[model samples]
Structures are given as C-alpha cells and as structure tokens.
Target: MTDRTPPAPSLAQLRALIAVADAGGFGEAAAEYGVSQSSLSEAVAKLEALAGRPLLRRTPGGTVPTEAGARVLTHARAAVQAAADALLAAQEENGGLSGTLRVASMRSAATHLLPPALAAFRARHPRVTVALLDSDAGGGGAPAVRSGRADLAVILADEAPDLRLSPLPPDEYLFVAPAARGTHPVTLAELGAAPLILPPHLDSCYRRIRTYLAARGVSLTAVSEVEQDSVILSMVGHGLGVTVMPRLALLPLPPGLVALPLPEPLARPLALAALPHRAGLPVIRAFTQAVLSHLPVPELPAKEPGPLPVPVSAPPLN
Candidate 1:
C-alpha cells in the first residue's frame, strides 16, 4: 500500500481566492490579480482541492464564499495581508538604502519635527522616496508600524513599547481657546468653568491630557469632541470652544487662536518607534539615523505661549 499526501495551498493560490472573493467574480478578480480568468479559476480550484471542499459558489448574480469558504476566507485575507507586508519588507531590504521609506505620524510631528529631518534625509539619500501617513486617515502610526505597513512611526510614550522608543523632547501641554477669547495661561478651575472642546478618547494626546488632569483630581466636561488637532484649533479660532493640546500643535495655529502654557505644565513623552527586527533594513536604519541627527536642532525664537500668527502649508496624509 502507498500513501500520498495532498499539497499545501500556495500563497499565490490563496491570494487568487482572496482577490476573487473581494472582487466578487472571476473576471474582476482575474483583473485584480493581473491574470487571465481561466488561470485564476485553476488556482482557486487547486486551493479548494487542498481543502477537500468547494471554497466558493459561483451563483449567476456573482461569486460568494461557501459556508466553509467564508471561514477559510477570513484566514485567507489575513494571510494575504501578511504576505503583502512581507513582500514590502523584502523589497525594502533588497533596495538597499534607496527605496520607499513609509512613515506615519500625528499632524504636529509630521509638520514640525519631521520636515527638517525629511529635508536633511532627502539631501543625504536623494534616491529614497518618502511616504508620509497621517493618524486620522487611519488609527495612527503605531498601529501602522506594528502591522508592517510602515517603516517608521511617531507615537506617544504611553502607547509605545519600551524597547523601541527613540525618545524626543517631551511635548508640553497648552491651553487653546477661541482667538476672540485671547491667549493666556488658564487655571484648571477656570478651564473647568468653560464648555471644553476635548480631544476624543482615541487620541494619544487625549489620554495624556486626561491622565494629567486625573492626577490633579480634575476631569474634563467636554462640550464638543473633535478628532483632528488642526480642526480642534480651527474650532477654537472660531470661538466654538476651548481645548488642550501639546505645544508642538501650535506650529500652525489658525488665524484667530490663543495657545498658552497650562498653569501647571504637563507634557507627554514622545518617541520615534521602529521594529527591532527591521533594524537590518538599510532604508529604515538610515532614516532612524537621519532623524536622530536632525530631531534636536535648536528651537526658533517664539512668542511666550500666546497667539503669534505662525503659519504653515497644508501637509499630505498617507
């Protein structure tokens, strides 16, 4: 008697299945996979054979996953996402110091801390393409880097892993209010009296602000919840309400706004984090070095924590 073992499904077969399911048909899926319809069908068939069952049902209206297919497809999607990340990492590794470098950060860090560093980094490695990601567009940089979608990420000290932090100067807290109200340091009691415009629960800065206040036995009564720090600043400028954010956020304060140091100075530790396993990649390694070199330049002269009419161009989101 002879025993024959079935072959495991290949990544290509798995991707073909995922593409077909996502695109909802063999024709579209084939286009997505850059293969002919017949070839895609063959790949899916091979995958289904390995599972010893039909993975998809081809109804006239469209292709839908079979009951078992749906369960397996969940795993397939994860596998595909993982494979895509691996492919990206492999490409970066193979490209030496001159391929795409994906970066994700909150708006302030992206606007203030990153611009000089990026300019200097580009000057040194002109061949590398820099891709910047914004936090609100998705969850944020930390999640992006964790999932391998980005080479580097800027994250708050609280949410970041202890091992990977390339710490930056702590970002100090500030009281921001409507431009009409004007800028001046406000006491916690005075701040509590107003209808506060607070950052949503999701923001790292929100947690920082909340934790700082919580330590002082104060809790915010939020009148409005805003997401983008820029929008929050804009709302303050419009006299919608008052809010608290980091000093770095004041770089591009809106036309009519007041930013003041809180009566009690509160700051959160900030860092540039990267996966230690990716240190061997030249692009990430070089960028980390370049940022470390460029992050600590002396601050330009600034007005004493009030609306000084500083301006900046709009930055792109990834």
Candidate 2:
C-alpha cells in the first residue's frame, strides 16, 4: 500500500482560524476576509483535519474556540502577526519608510565623517533608526552584510563588486603636522623628509600616503607605523611626527594639529555599499539622500600659509 501524507496548513487556513476566533462566527470571519462563508468553513475544516482535532465549538455566546482551538489559535495569531510584519518590510522597500537599518563603516570614516551625515539623516527621517557598526578597513563589514548583520556599509567605491557601490565624496589626502610647526603649505617631498607617523597600509587605500610618495620620487624617513588614524593624528598633534592621510580622517583636527592639502591631491572615492538589491530600499535611499544633501565633496582650499583655526569640536584622542 502507498502512504498518503497530509498537506500542511496553508496561510488561508491559518487566517480562517484566527478570524473565526476574533469575529466569533464563520459568516463574520468570511466577511472579514472577503470570502464566502462556506469557503471559510472549509478552510477551518482543513485545519482540523491537518491537526486531527476539532478546533471550534458552538456556544450560546456566539462561536467559541474549543480548548484545542484556543491553543492552535494562539499560534495562529502569532503566525499571522509575523506574516504582517514580513509584508510590512516588503512594503517599506517600496515606500513605507519606518524601520531600523544596520550600517557598517570603517573606523576612521565612522569617527570623523559619518557623524554629521547621520545627524542630518536623523533630522530628516526621525522615524528610521540607523545602527552603526565599526569595522577594520579590510574586514568585519563583508561578513556583516552577507550574514544579515548589516543592511548597509560605507566603503570605497571600487573595493567590492558584491557590495553594490554608490558614490559619495572622494576624500583627498592631507599632510598633518603639529600647529606649532606652523603650517607653510608643505609639499609631499617636504612631508616625506619629516618624522612620519602612519597607519599600516590598508586595502581601501592601499597605503595611500606611501603609494603617492612612491610615485613622486619620495620615500618615508624616520617613520613610525601606528595602527589607527586617530592615534596617528594624536601622535602628529603632540609633535612626535608628521603624517599624511585623508583630509576626512583628521577632520576637526585636535587643538595642536593642522592639515595641508597636497599640491597634487591623492584621494580615494567613498560610496554607499550594500547587497545590490538593498540599495533602492526606502531607508537606504533616505540615508544616501541625507549624505548627498549635506557633505559636499570638499574642494581643496588654497594652501594655508599660516596657522588656521583649530576646530573646537574635535574628538578627544589628540
């Protein structure tokens, strides 16, 4: 003899059970779902057959769930709510913008660049939540977006094809030194001659400062490598050494540090990256719009031949 397996309950069956409990009768439940009373009854009957137990009782107090029906309806209500939430998420992708977004970013950019953009984003989309995750330039982000740990990442425009990239402002490299050194618009060759503090050569930038120097017949001398941009900026501010890094990295430079734009700017394109399909979602669109609307690509200023104003709002490391 061949074995026959029962089919699992469909969404229709589950909805019928929950509606019947709420509306208290097959006719009322059918009206709620815009279906015929007979169809609703049949759907509940299928649920009972699948569970191998009766799920409803006729009582003077309209229609009531039997003990078994009460238990099954509890699960049915939960499943229904989950379905509604799933649909709501899909709707949000279209135009229903109210959900939390998990965002990923590298340490330097997160500390210096993202704050203003995020604050602007919050001002615009007060209902949306953006959770930022700090990552090493080369790691932490890939696994995050791939494993559903993050919805978006701000990374270099051309770094990863899998992460669909949308352009933000490209960040230009700057020569950073102690203010007491009295910035006189130092050239790359002059910067190379100073005691240098720097981060390890990284992937998004590929040792940006060094690569540019290599191209210009310059080389590091009396150099010290620190692993964090914030630390490097701090070291440079303290007059230990001078360093070259993205202008965005030394933003709001500490009390004693100063930035000089390179004569020939060395820069890396930064962009919003996400699983290709996620780029168009409403929350992501909102974030990207906020970024574009606020942070314009900084046009390199004329070389400041003297000490400029120190930004009082700079973060504490320096």
Question: Which number leads on lDDT?
Answer: 1
Can you write out model 1's per-residue Cα lDDT over 179-276, one digit (the tens) per residue? 66755557888676776777787666767777777888776565577877778777777777788877777776666677777878788788888877
Q: For model 1, state the Cα shift of residue 1 in Å.
A: 15
**Candidate 2's residue-wise lDDT over 1-318, tens digit each?**
876875778888988987888789988887877889998889999999999999998787778899999888777865665564464446553344677778888776776667777887676666777888876743666656654557778777655767877777787777778777666767767867889877765544436667777888887688787887778877887778887777666666677777776767788888777766566666776677766676644554654544433443523221
Estimate the TM-score of every prediction: 0.72, 0.63
True-structure RMSD, every candidate: 5.1, 14.3
Question: Any idea what lDDT model 1 has?
Answer: 0.75
The Cα RMSD in angstroms, rounded to one decimal, for candidate 1 relative to the true structure is 5.1
* Alpha-carbon shift of residue 2 in model 2 (angstroms): 9.8
Q: What Cα-based lDDT does every candidate model obtain? A: 0.75, 0.72
